[model samples]
Target: MIRPVAVIGAGPYGLSTAAHLRARGIPVRVFGSPMVSWREHMRAGMLLKSTPVASNIDAPQPGHDLIDFCADTGERRYESDWDLVPVEIFARYGQWFADKLLPDLERVRVVSVDRAGAGRDGFELKLDSGEQFTARAVVVATGLSGLARLPRELAAATSDGLSATGPFSHAAQHRDVSRFAGQDVIVIGAGQSALENAVLMAEAGAASVRVVARSRGAVAFGDAPDRQSRLRPESPFGRAWSLYGLTYHATHVRRLPAPARHYLVRRVLGPLGAWWLRDRFTAGRIQVTDGRRVVRARVEDGRPVLTLSGGQGAGRELSADHVMAATGYRMDVAALGFLGHELRTALSVSRGAPRLDAGYGSSVPGLYFTGLAAAASFGPVMRFVCGTEYASPRVARAVEVR
Candidate 1:
């Protein structure tokens, strides 16, 4: 009998995982578009937090590689610098790799996954298209779609008049939001998205753009150094990179205990990239309200009013025409509807993430995870597109069937 395998979530991690398994002579069924959500949802001109080279899915093997595709087409987007890749170029790269590598993929969504047999050795995946698939093993590369987290205050205010998300939607449509010129805009959270959008709104003629951050300020650069610099301490990016390299060079990220890895991740990755967009945040006369949280948001006379509270029980009320939340995301298994009750109950969880082994397989047999969901087990790097190279191969080895 032919072995059956399914790769879920056709993003970089999922596609790459499928490609690697296919290359290893495994029969793979891949679903979803290659970078479809990223291309459609993210704003134009948004630069990636990951370097192009670090973002490759499959390790270079003879005759098949992203670099070769770029070389053939003369697409220089594959050779990006500054550790930031543009979204458009990355999308093209993914499409190119998909066309040349794995082309037989299902574009439908997997709605639910459940045990198919009495032995529970095989699994059944139900698709939104009313089709069902039984596979020996399943890899959920669905990426981070289920985890777009907004602040509780912002989430509550979204029902009110305040438009807390999609500040860039207008900008992405190339509409000049100059009508709001000199208008008040309050941005919640200090992440790169918050700062970047705040800058855009300020540039679009918002009179006063204020950013409320739980951190001290808009992130500053050189905070999380690149991996390359870590290999050599005296390199241009400096000691932070060198330290990072030294830390990961000796031991594989998989070998480290999950808790220790997560702690290291919290220290090294969290709030670090927020610094990269500091220049953009500081570009115009945008205001920074750091070390504060928005306690309440209410509409008054069609204006969004916010009550900000600081650490010492201090409070201030500010009004804005618009509020945007860039508070990042959480990965609770409950958010993933496809996971059946048995799988969800069997899998270990730390915080909101599914606990996985070194190869990114969950505690439940034959059900593996990769990319962001696997970050809790794999380390901070695993949370990024850059880490997919490591994650894809490991997952392929674990779940790929002959």
Candidate 2:
């Protein structure tokens, strides 16, 4: 019997996991579309958080890389991770790579995963199409679909007429501001998506667009790059960059103390990303309220009204035509509901993530997690495309072939 390796999710990380396993002569079964989240969640004009130089999956051959694809396509290539990428193009690239290498991948959805027994070497997987199978090992690489964290208060008070959910069209869905021609729009959060949403609203001809931030300005840990700055070599101050063999040289990326890494990420990296997006955001014709927090929201007059407060002040209320949030994500283990109680109970998690060994294997034997869910233990880099190259091989070597 061919005890295949089962991979959940067909997003970039899932596809990359499948590709790596296949290269080792492992019979891998993958579920979902390549870059499904990007196709559904991300806006069209939005660019990748990382530049071309920092984005790639682990390819068996040396030249099968993201930069090479960009060079061949005459796309703009930047040396630093600070550069932007159009969401559509990046998603297309993943599709292109997956089609070329892992054509046997299935796009069917995974409904549930269960454990047959403690002594069993494999897992029982149930698919939405009414198919069931056993795998020698199972890897969950579902990416962001499992969770879309929103403020608890916001989630409870809103309905579809005034709710936050995926597949909700952003600015890219409309060609002109005429669709929003007479509505008062409110954008929450100061991340890239929030700025992009604000721009889209203004361009869409919203009667007015109000952007609220918890911070004084959008908090980015790094500074924006000028022409001279963009030409600099890859380093901490320049933004993390990894070339063909350069990633191995950075011991910090692999061995920093958790506290130190967290501090650096909070004080340095997080602010830098916000800085890069600042200019593009300010260029828009919109209203921005700094240092305000949304404490409560309610639907009033068929529109949404928000009560906001400053760090050291009493609350004040504001209303909008519609409120949209780009507040970012949280990698909660409970998000993987498709993994039934049997399998989930067997998994150990710390701070909402599966606690894993350096090899990406979880406490449960023959079960693993990579990509976003793995970042809590591995470091922030694990959340990005760049981290895939390092994590894939560890899982490929640890899991037995079919």
Candidate 3:
């Protein structure tokens, strides 16, 4: 019997990996909702931080890029992740890619995954539907699902669902920005998500929106690439480049010292918005309180209140109907609760992320990680859609077809 290699996500990395494996005549199964992050998590009318060329999900076959999708569907192309062509078009592009290459893609959530088969060689998977399955190997490409990094102060007030009017939420919670219409909002963090979400809430009719970040000064966008500037070479990481070495040389990145690899992933892409979002966000519309940090948060009178520490002083109090944390994501392997304790314990970790090899495999054989989770080993490109071009084929070859 040819035991299938299970791909645990249906996003860009998941779909691309499965496509590559199938092209190699390796039996594979892909699971999870297609493009859930782009379709539900993002705000309406939000633009992508990446350029049109950088947003493609890779596949082994040629002509499967975004240009082909635009030709087939007649979807209007955009200059970047935002503007006229919203994220909706990109989500549609992912689904179109799935339909074209991954016809048997399983739109289901994996509940748990643990060691299975001889010598704990294979994997046992339980789905949300209570169905059980086994595979020769498992690819953990669960994109940013459990990696949301929320401030401890606001953690108490945060909830995944906005069943009733909510006090706070994370940008990754997939909450609809329209829900906060006519309500005051406080968006935390100094990155693209924070700035863009603030702009989105203002457009969504939030009564008032304010951005409070530990970084100083007004909102700043990254430098656009020009002949004179080499630091801001055009790539998926946007304004950021590989200060350590060649930007896309992910293979070279993995062989570097642990500290160097970590530094490249963290420092290379710090908090900065896209060049195009500059005019969209201004001091007049979304009030900015830079050089401030949220020290404590509590709900008073059915509203979320935050105590600020930095910037001015420690006694500052800011209240809003809701608070949103765009603090960004961290690649922590422990946060992936679906991996049973025994399996997680056996898997090696570095800096809270799975320590992966050049082929994207973790310490445990037959198990692999990709996407942002693989950023620690593969460099920051794993955080973007175009990274699939580099990652998918490597992971496909790494997973054995038994």
Q: Which candidate is the best by lDDT?
A: 3
Q: Candidate 3 has what TM-score? A: 0.91
* Model 1 weakest lDDT span, ten residues long: 166-175
Enumerate clash totals for all models, in the order shown. Answer: 5, 10, 4
Candidate 1 local Cα displacement, residue 213, angstroms: 0.6
For each candidate, what TM-score against the reference? 0.85, 0.84, 0.91
Q: On lDDT, who's better, 1 or 3?
A: 3
Give the per-residue lDDT of model 2 (tens digit) for 36-147: 7888767646666666656676676675577666676786664455666677878777887788788988989888888766777778888989999988888999887746
lDDT (tens digit, per residue) of candidate 1 on 57-80: 564365435466667788663543
Q: Model 2: runs farther than 4 Å from truth? A: 70-83, 117-119, 159-181, 219-237, 240-268, 271-276, 311-313, 400-402
lDDT of each: 0.68, 0.69, 0.81
Candidate 3 clashing pairs, residues 3+ apart or interchain: 47-81, 47-82, 48-81, 48-82
Ranking by lDDT: 3, 2, 1
TM-score of 1: 0.85
Residue 374 alpha-carbon offset, candidate 1, angstroms: 0.7
TM-score: which candidate is best? 3
